[model samples]
Target: MWEVMSDPQSSLALPVTRLTRRKTLDQVTAECQSHDLKRTLTATQLTLLGVGATIGAGIYVMTGEAAADYAGPAVLVSFVIAALACLFTAFSYGELSSTLPVAGSAYSYAYVSIGEGAAWTVGWLLLLEYGISCAAVASGLSGYATSLLSDLGVHVPAALSQSTFQTVLSGANLTLTVGPRLDFVGGLAVMIVTALLVRGVQESARVNAVIVVIKVGVLFVFVGFGLQAMHAAYWHPFIPQSEGGFRYGLPGVFRAASIIFFAYVGFEAVSTAAAEARNPRRDVPIGIVLSLVICTAVYILVASVLIGIVPYRELGVADPLAIAVNAMHEPWLALLIKVGATVGLCSVLLGLLYGQTRIFFSMSRDGLIPAAFSRVHPTLRTPWIGTILLGILVAIATATMPLEVISDLVSIGTACAFGIVNFTVIWQRNTRPGITRPFSVPLGGITIGGFWIGIAPALGIAFCVIMTLPLCIDLLRALGNGNPLPAILLGIYIVIGIATYFAYGRSHSRMAQAPFDAD
Candidate 1:
């Protein structure tokens, strides 16, 4: 065992051997069949799960910030653009999930179509996408919770509700300064969601479904009242001219689209639950596409109402929707909206935490991580260890860091993962022509000189790459402005992942021991 552990071949082999090693479809299917997670999720439940994941604190909070800082009344256009990008990527995800129908979402798809190294990289990115996303959403939830409590004549002390560094905006200039505080509310919210997740998947799904109904219903109410009260003059200069670069012009629209793209993060989480899905081939695709459609429509309507009823300049608060409701002088409705935002954020936290645990579970089972992470509760059948540990880490993050910092990191990570998934679909179609894809991406038969071209995946790749540019710019801007902490932290994470692969995962992978026989 020590010889195997210390083998020089094991250390050097990861670059060549692991990169060439691909998990066969048969092996993936066998693992899915043998996995301990119960198949209890139906198409309806899955759809709600996607909605529960997608429509969260982002819509409730970021819509205002995006509108005020970037797109103005054209925020609706930004939402449409982001939705279109997500739609393209969702189609590719639909095809892959239908074909693979395993846990780990893109990570599992990459393992089969790409290779071990690519799979590990995608898994590492997913940890950022789902785990940090939970932290960001939990922090957002804390703000809404505070507002709700304030309405009930209870106020949280500033020292217990805010971050150490406070960001203050003046005109187009932003400043960050030291103002130490601990976000106990955010930490508590994560802990509560984590406890609920460890109890079981089915129970969590049920709770998520209920939360989806409440939040969606509240959004409809907002639309109903907002349209009635909208003043056409507020939207006069729809795409307000930019005072400077990336501020309320076409550039701002695209930038806002990239920023608000975080709103669509949850649809991919649906695919992560494929192993627990009752009819993965049919239901997973339906869940992915249907949820995107539902959420996009809601987002467009909500953004329009928000800017129509309240000018875009005034919409840049933590609870934008509630603030819009409050402007109408309907105290009861404002309370209801506040409640919806809080519940909505809780559901998002739950879905992300669930996806994060499943990703770790799949990687661990493949021997890329510790086996203890893969252990499912005997009766509950959930990856309790990973779930608890991730929850603790997220709690600490939410309690310490500001929302914007965590959210920006999540956007970059999610975009990279989406780009990889889109490329994986194109690669799989080109290399494995005969593989059975239960749901093939539409418009793939435009043959040009004996070669087939898939339009959807191609568009998917373009859109994902386009959305990532703004995030990269934001990262650079942050670094240039002396806010290098998030970038440094993300770099450290990637380095650790690469180091772990070389030191342990490379030698221990099940595929390294016995390569999958495609036949």
Candidate 2:
């Protein structure tokens, strides 16, 4: 990996345009900038941003599902495998944070360092990863809300909560259908996050930190209470039946790794907050690894308790934790867990939205998308337009959908981006000898950071691409007679991105037009 960049200066991005020196880009460009988003986040605030952006239905709900359907009590091992994989990739991120410390996460880094086309495509993918993924998160939050309401004596009417088809079917059986409703809770959370982010990164991060505390507190409560009911029997035969011998003499860990992979979603968010960090070199790496480690530890521990309390067969379902508590004859605890889930999801939605808007901000700045999107509001200092646009779209998704499709899509998208980060770090390491590094791998012997992060990306891309083809074929076949517009729209999104880059971004790109100069 270290051999790839022997003479970076020869191939490195010489400043494309001589905009100015010793002047932060935001200040010089602020006047022309499309958005008013402020940069006030500190290291701690960024850490909380990492924390807030991290958890959601993945842990509270998906854990049991993994245990039951995929891994069983050995799901804890699955969590470990996934965490270790992320740990590897995060190290590469730590290296990049020290070197580039820019916003746009990996996309921005790729653009300025790699070339115009790479940046544009990565930026497009980041949108799918962060923006669409957040929408997916909001949808997941809505599902959790329904489960919470059911725990209480009061339940939502089916017409409000269930999908139109589910409601129709249930109504045929009984006079009324009980269902999960779509309150604006998911949408409202996005709004609140937008407001905070609008206020400034510093303030928003502080608020996010507080929310993270609550979310973590909720997880802890579950862990502590759930631990009381733990039984070791669940740990027997950790690796269940599998197709081949792999990873641990059984492919179970790999299978578990894929299913539990989404649990580690928030790790990349540190890269997103790179611009606001005081010391990107130092803090970005620290925050990324620190947060990933802490979260992984928590996940494994909590998973252990979840399995200990229940058998593997019963753990694999949506909202597994609540379902587990329901089994303990402590339905009331499940109710609280349900309510806690609602609160935890609040932080998840807000954090994911915060990340989504920033990606657009970077893309707009780079001239990838319409420069109009980069504009800041004069008074609010936030990207009000972009925030509102994303908010509405995500809100609608939350109102009318299930978590399955979106969740898988997000995981696949995220994995693709993750793979890129790993390779980029390796590319930089081999080429840029003088590249400044703020943080390095916690263990610096051989560079494994690239490989660790690369696995998920590999797995994600392979799986998603594989999965997408079948879905597309089915969708086209099923909807040929009906409105088939959604399928058509998805095709247009990518085409529009490629078209926009060629039509506009290419001409305006600093790399293409400006001369090299050290900033």
Candidate 3:
């Protein structure tokens, strides 16, 4: 006999269990074993994937500007702070990915520990995180690519090379101004990566690994060459006094940390590759932790050398690293850095696009979205349709939008998803104590009110929340002063997400067909 429960909130007699349904660990593991994504990714490839994603525009482009505008020499401290926050979240991810070994990353973990609704919410946030982030990276890539071309005597018209819109803040009001330009270069870049992704995961990983080597080598060359020109006097005002708000001071360091938190966002890309990892249990955790550790080291070393070689105030340009390389009196090195950045961003695009497609693949398998997203190509064994569709949407957005204005929104979305991952660890510990965890978060916790909250996850949640504060405060300040565009856009996205869930997902969810399994 099947046991049933009532849904007091619904008139359609939908079972109450469907509203708060949790997928069993056994089910998730079984699905991973049977998934269509080819298990071709090795530990090295996965680590490089994480590196490829994490090391792009953030270090090459944002670092110098962050130091100049917000943190000064203290941006090194800012990187450490952001890395610590991601470290906690990465630890939580390591444990869960090893346990579940599923495609959706945080969304899949949420489905197993929390309810389906929360899983959908996490998936929605991930869409915002990875999708918009890909567009933003492509937009940044356009700048480097266009510059590199001009250096070679090849010129692209500004109308075909620039974004169609710009976000401006005048006094208190925020306005979006249209322009007669289109980012064809960025759009073409997105399509090229999309084509590579559709070919197969292994092929994309190989390309990404090669690009990673080139960029990492480029950065190392800068560090090695720039060290001899170090000016210790540049380090005197380590912590610049506050110039009001988060402009320059200790507050500015935290503010800079919030912005550069985007740098650490892609470390979780390792978890998203779980379904394709050859040995997901061991490899996923290794990839997640190792990539973060390496990238953080690189960020700190590069920032230290950059500040030593050049005054922080001069780093606010689009090419901070190039400026530092020029300061080394090595124009050749500057050219190399620009070329590396241009090639390097393709790997970032590859990793992010791969993550986004796989996440939707997982969601589609769960029946939350259309089944077309999960359909695997017969020859390539890749989710071709979804990959192409998402790539097109992102490319269009990259061409049309002024992504700089909404980049922090990606940071906020990532932190929210990461917080949920940490929370899932705590929740799973309490609810499914007997389940085998191939890896576990370090720093065990005591039972608090009958719920065991691991120290790592607790701090992970706290760190994510703390990192999110400065960004949220900035958004609120903009809203209070008269700019409502960002808040309005976020609200619209949430409303559409809710409407989609209730209109289609709630009724069509796979859990709706299965009996509640308390065991």
Global Cα RMSD, each model: 3.2, 8.0, 1.9
- Evaluate residue 382 in candidate 2 and report its C-alpha lDDT on the 0 to 100 scale: 70
Runs of candidate 1 with Cα error greater than 4 angstroms are 1-14, 163-180, 445-451, 481-483, 516-519
- 1 against 2, candidate with superior lDDT: 1
Q: For model 1, name the residue pairs that clash.
A: none
Instruction: Please give, for residues 114-205, the per-residue lDDT of candidate 2 as tens digits.
Output: 55556666777777767776766665666677666665565756555543212222321212233555645555555666666666666667
lDDT of 3 by residue, 393-475 (tens): 99999999998878788889888999999999998889878887888999999897898989999999998998899989998
Residue range 193-270, candidate 1, lDDT tens digits? 899989988999999999999999998988998888888999979899987867888989999998888889998889
Q: lDDT of each prediction vs. the true structure?
A: 0.85, 0.63, 0.90
The TM-score values for the models, in the order shown, are 0.92, 0.77, 0.96
Better of 1 and 3 by lDDT: 3
Candidate numbers, best TM-score first, in rank order: 3, 1, 2
The local lDDT score (0 to 100) that residue 160 gets in candidate 1 is 87
Evaluated at residue 175, the lDDT of candidate 2 is 22
lDDT of 2 at 89: 70
